[model samples]
Target: MNNYPFGSQAPKSFPAYPKTEFDLESGTAIKRTRKPKNSPFHPLRMIKSFGNRFHHFFKLHPLMGLFLALCFVLALAMILSLYGTQYGVQSGGYVKSDMGFDDYPFSKLQNLVMVAGHSIYTSSSCGKIEKEDSWFLESYQKNPGQAATFVTHIHEGIEIVARDDSALLLFSGGETRRDAGPRSEAQSYWAVADSKGWFGKEESVKWRALTEEHARDSFENLLFSVCRFRELTGTYPQNITFVMENRVGALEKLASDQGEKLTDVM
Candidate 1:
């Protein structure tokens, strides 16, 4: 018999049974699980676990740690750039200025013997252009151009010099190459002009061509060519012309010497 109200919610009661455990296919009681003392639910334990992971990462790759440190420093630099100290016109900048046209004594010369120094060949032009043909490199390396870019200026110089009656066209370069034999750069230009037909008045222009050997540089080319010009004409050049990319300064230096006169043309 139950001791509970019939019409109300009744209190639960355990069924009468033996004190010994019953077997469901020889079953037994199992222990229940408890919460870990250092679980993620504990804030300090979670912090410690994260710190350990970071430490393990650094220990695995020292280089990776260094890379992270460098990134941090670079980020700092980028942030600092906002202060205008990193970039501005007045803050560590570069600008270029041009050398404008100014009159030079060589600017008025008639017997213009344009001596373009080794800057055109044996140096700038030769080393830069690798085209193994008539380029300054191949020509100077194998056989020197009758005049090289020097001839280009020489032709220009001759045009100016031809304005007068007495003008000599001279090109100078030594046997810089072993295979080219004993021919100087001057002789090569003479041959090319003679062979190529010197533009109508071939014989007349060919008579004006001269050669100067032993000039290894621009100064030597100018000075030696001047001496050769004086020797040929039996008088110093009344008006010496220098045709160059930029000839004023160089011509100034040469013309300022004792008994030398020159005029510069761009």
Candidate 2:
């Protein structure tokens, strides 16, 4: 009966929460939502976060990574090669080879050989011909058996080698004049040279009168003398002194360029 007395009373009520909807019609359409945070250990996050770290991991660990690195290197090398081939290099620059010899050193040079040339002597065996036939003929005839030319040149070379005990003198030429025989022109002049002597040093002068008999032109003078120089010294001559008349600037320049190109082709 007591329970029935409260029939008109209502049951206990629960708390209600307000709705959180946006009102687009009222200009409040935007709403904020929290982003899902990335894990510090995830694969995508690791790749995006570290550049070199990911690259190094790929490089050292797997065959595919090593192959890719090698491919990249090869591509870079090819690009550089193409660039160098296009531009090449400038002219007249000194190129040093790994095993190149030093130039002839005049001061430290021992066993020095100076070859003073005369067109008459070089062409003597060919017999007399037109003035135009010999390159040095006109100059030789003008100077005419001056002996002073070779004498003066020899003196200079002697003075250069006087202090060094190892030096030797080399006289080079052939019998080019019609009056001359096949006998070496170097020997003929050197005999006259032996009698006159070198100022007070005739002993020094007589001891070093070696000869080379095959030079026909200035080019031959240099080339043949160099061969002779090499043969006597066991090694090539350390220094070669030349005494001649006129413009030799072109001679050496052409010889060096053509020689290098020809050598490369071979």
Candidate 3:
């Protein structure tokens, strides 16, 4: 018994490690730990990965992406072009009248009756102007009625013309509304006058009644009508009568500044 080298005591045994499992048929080791759960930024990571993948896709399909981009640009350009044309028409784009300055019959007219337009009439027939709805109702609330005031303006204009047979009557306005299309306020007033037969002086006033369809405001109404009178008659009016509800002081100042004579028609 004492023949052993370490004969005094028996050797202590060490603890045994657990055996790693493996597939017996394939001889592959099994996974011991599960993959860590994705972090809160997993979606961002996935988007980055997708972007890289798409980058590769674009590299492989460059022609398709370029075509799609070109198509988008063209569609945007078309939309802008259409919008620009529509806006141009609504904002008083160039329009030629059937009657030119050479066609004006009264070349020696020196007096002018300028009526400023306030609203666009909806009706096509001038006879129905009284029944037509105007663009703005608030501006006409202080008057008897929109249509009544409009008729009164026409009457006043024609009365001035009837009083003096040498005066040229001009209605001034521009296309001011998008929904109203390209119809000018000046045209509306002239149509109403025509429908009313120049308020009983059709014989004397019809030939002299004209329109300045490019004026956008009160100042333009005064200034443009003068210019139009010159263009038609080849001379500036010796006396000017402005028919409008407001802006009399401004018109007077404008006339004074421009060294033009304006007669207040009460």
Candidate 4:
């Protein structure tokens, strides 16, 4: 009774699905969800709600609203000022230091030990400066073994700085020798110290060792170095020390002029 034979082709009938019926979820969900009160998705609504509350408060007590706004502004200003102070450019130099203690070693080190330089090293030769002819000596300092004393002073200063972790060593003098072609005594001492390898404390004390090159006399050595210390460290020293006698009572008089006391090394 079939139109086609069993071994031949055959066709069957079925209901075709509509496109909307196939896409049922998009057309209509099983359960609809209502947005919660104070929904985060509605920012403009939240701002409008805040404005309404503020308006109500302002209408009730205008003085209170003014006071509250003033307080908020003050607090915001305080916060900005604090951040600005913490993050602003300091000193405004071409080479400005960061607002951290790590880069400022001299500030952390509180004590100063000054070595008064006596002569300029006038050597055209290199390195063996423990002898007499290497220095630009005065007539009085023309004797043998006199140049070695300068090296000794540098060594002693380095040793002291090495022993005290909080001390900075300074070689202080100026270019008093006009005939020596602008070489300063402070520079000479530093060069000698460098040649000596900072007396074996190169790693520990060499970096702390520096020179004050504008001191033309023993008094200037003290005065200029103190100013130099303040310039570099941003604070005055708690104490100062150097090895020299009151040869002409100038140091004693300088101390008296400032209303301070000096303990005589003699």
lDDT of 3 by residue, 198-249 (tens): 7789998888899999988888999899989987886788889988877787
Ranking by TM-score: 4, 3, 1, 2
Score candidate 4 by lDDT: 0.77
Preferred candidate (lDDT higher): 2 or 4: 4
Which residue pairs in candidate 3 have backbone atoms (N, alpha carbon, C) closer than 3 angstroms, thus clashing?
none
Q: Please give, for residues 46-126, the per-residue lDDT of candidate 2 as tens digits.
A: 667786775778967878878877999999999998776555343555333222234422222245454545644333442
lDDT by residue for model 4 (1-266), tens:
75776553656545465433344567542444667788357889989999999999999999999999999999999999876665655357334334454455578887777888888998876476877888888899898888777777777788778888987788889999999988898888888888788889999998888889999888898888777776667666666777553453677677667654333321
Alpha-carbon runs more than 4 Å astray in model 1: 1-112, 115-132, 135-151, 244-251
TM-score of each: 0.44, 0.43, 0.57, 0.58
Model 1 C-alpha RMSD vs. true structure (Å) is 21.4
Candidate 2 TM-score, C-alpha based: 0.43
Residue 131 alpha-carbon offset, candidate 1, angstroms? 8.3
Cα RMSD, each candidate: 21.4, 21.0, 15.7, 15.3
| Candidate 3 residue runs with Cα over 4 Å from true position | 1-105, 132-144
The better-scoring model by lDDT among 3 and 4 is 3
> Could you give the candidate ranking by lDDT, starting with the highest?
3, 4, 1, 2
Clash numbers, per candidate? 7, 6, 0, 0
